[model samples]
Target: MAGWAAAAALLLLPLFAVQFTDGVNWEMVDFSVFGAMLLGAGVSYELAVRMTGSSAYRAAVGVAVAAAFLLVWINLAVGIIGSEDNSANLMYGGVLAIAVIGAAIGRFQSAGMTRALSATALAQVLVGIIALAAEFGSTAPSFPEAIVLSTGFFVALWLLSAYLFLKAASG
Candidate 1:
């Protein structure tokens, strides 16, 4: 539940940042959003493993998520169904890959440690938002617009994370 809430907050961050300043780039925003989602997944996975005391299940879930991310990366890399912006595609794909690696590590390591790492991931998202806001200055009307956009985005992300967490927890 906490993990989902964190992810929800992260998803809203980009829109908020964007509304505050037009200078925000999609790559950075996407990186932050995906990073948060991955972090949430790790947290949920760690909790599940801790409760079940089964490393096999942890590894299985990690691998499955990683494999799915890899497929998405490939699709984006090849421009199969979306924009062909190589830089954005590569940036997003690399971030997802890193997340997968982190998940893999979490699966094999101590659950408590993995949970800590997941918390760090969530912190990174908040830090990114602060950095973006700082860079843009807080004087503009766009600041409010950004906040609204981010709120919506975060809410959606939170719901998604919560759903995923519940599903993973139950399984």
Candidate 2:
């Protein structure tokens, strides 16, 4: 309940921002989509917490779920490496697809969740690699060094997620 409230408040921040400043330009569709995203994240997190018994496990799951939500949200709003139009951005789907498939096949058990997270982490690393290749292949790579560093961060997060899932499963 608290989480959902916080999510609602956080979602409202942008709405408030738009009214106060021209810098925050968002359409109805943006609000609708982002609201849905935040709602889903909150619900999913609450569910995870309710389902898990261990506080450590809950914390780990919470972090992983939050990271996943942010990854998808950021990808949709702006390209992680570049624009949303970037082909490399498509790789984010791979992470979700792998996790869903793994969960479905493994019935969302600990081993299954661990494997799913590990696969997602791998996909994150691959996205980074692809982004780097795409950037270098272009006329000249721009500042902020698209893909490599950004992808690495995401990959590291996924790896930590995998570790948490693995620990939860073992303990």
Candidate 3:
């Protein structure tokens, strides 16, 4: 749990920086969405840990998700991968693939745990859509606002993945 919290905090730093630096005031809905995701991830990870009793499995899943997301994020950030076209699609597809792989692995090792992870992953996808909608709505946000908002979403995901990692490590 602590590890997850730390990871969440670390992931949030970039968003906080963008918000503070750019003087963006976050809306209540934005905060609520991010909070929900954080809560969901934590709950799912805890449930999976309890069900599987295999810390290694939990950690592997957590690390895999985090590493994959980080890799893509870095690619986008450094201009190594995503350009203008299809960036969103590519990122979404990558995330979906990771979730599917995680689900498959979980199913093979522990059905209950896999289901929990899958549920969390599904929630993540929904949240991503919501974030995207929020971003592109009537009043399109400024670059800073968009950055902060997206960062918040990623932070929540990192926290959830960290939770799994810690559970695996401890077990």
RMSD values, in order shown: 13.5, 2.2, 10.6
Better model by TM-score: candidate 1 vs candidate 3 = 3
TM-score of model 3 vs. true structure: 0.40
lDDT string for model 3 (93-159, tens) is 4554655565566563444344545455554455456545654232333433543455455545644
Ranking by lDDT: 2, 3, 1
Better of 2 and 3 by lDDT: 2
- Residue pairs whose backbone atoms clash in candidate 1: 8-158, 12-150, 12-154, 16-146
In model 2, where is the ten-residue run with the lowest total lDDT? 136-145
Overall lDDT per candidate, in order of appearance: 0.46, 0.75, 0.51
lDDT for each residue of candidate 2 in 1-171, tens digit (9 for 90 to 100): 677788889889999999999988999999999888888877777777778786656766676677778788877876676777666677788877886687678675666777887888888777677667656324334424656666777777777877787888888
**lDDT agreement of model 3 with the native:** 0.51
Worst 10 residues of 3 by lDDT: 77-86
Instruction: Give the per-residue lDDT digits (tens) of candidate 1, residues 14-111.
Output: 66887788876557657764675567566756665676555444554454454444435344434221233423223334434544566566653444
Q: TM-score ranking from best to worst?
A: 2, 3, 1
